[model samples]
Target: MLSLFPQILFLAPLALTLLRVVLAIYLAYIAWYLLSRHAEIEHAELPIIGHARHGILWLSAISISAIAALLFIGAWTQVVAIFATVISLKQLVFYKRLKEILPFPPSTCILLLCISLTLIVSGAGGFAFDLPL
Candidate 1:
């Protein structure tokens, strides 16, 4: 295929950086939502973490927050992306029930999964702590 905008090809890194940031923000939103809902419910079953206790829910929320921070800063991006991928995959596989709990559409879960996989394959991109060796 012929190049439509070859001059802007160098900006690929920035695009990946944007993707990473966006994914980080979404993850943070999920964490916040989880925590807010966790307050209302004493116990609720969660995908990949069934029969959730109060402490488990809090731990999950904290873990998700940590992942979001790590992703936003682009530290250990591939590893973080791997964890994100797993979480999203779990959500996607259990989309029917997850939607009711998370209030996010299945499409959003699919998008999150795709973005996480992309980050895993592409690394942290520009302005990130991780540099390809």
Candidate 2:
């Protein structure tokens, strides 16, 4: 089973970049979903920081999408990685139970946290748009 997994050290940068892009899309989707289901979602006691207010959700979605775009283009890699790390940390701090969905379990949040940290340390690598086109 272990053989099926890629060598973490050898593929660290690519894995981190992929994880960052995946997380950005996931965060954007969650924001849009929360905004759409504000009444139902906010019925539970939510942290003020994680409130499902329209403005908050919209800003979250936009920011997450921007991060995703930056990650995709491999531009401002460190900055976007830091921003993602902050947002993920905020989610862990303020909204441990941000979702009740099946596919998006708590472990997913933890994985995102790890991914952000990896990107912050390893960076986007040679394939990044940071190089001349």
**Candidate closest to the true structure, highest lDDT:** 1
Q: Across residues 47-129, which tens digit of lDDT does each residue of candidate 2 receive?
A: 66554566765676677777877877778877787887787676666554655521255567678778777767777765687
Error of 2 at 133 (Å): 20
Candidate 1 per-residue C-alpha lDDT over 2-83 given as tens digits, one digit per residue, 9 for 90 to 100: 6899998899899989999999999999888877887554455664556677787788889999999999998999999999
Model 1, C-alpha of 92: deviation from truth (Å): 0.9
Strongest candidate by TM-score: 1
Badly placed stretches (over 4 Å) of model 1 are: 39-43, 46-50
Candidate 1: the clashing residue pairs are none
TM-score on alpha carbons, each prediction: 0.88, 0.67
Lowest lDDT 10-mer window, candidate 1?
A: 39-48
Please estimate how well model 2 matches the true structure, expressed as its whole-model Cα lDDT. 0.67
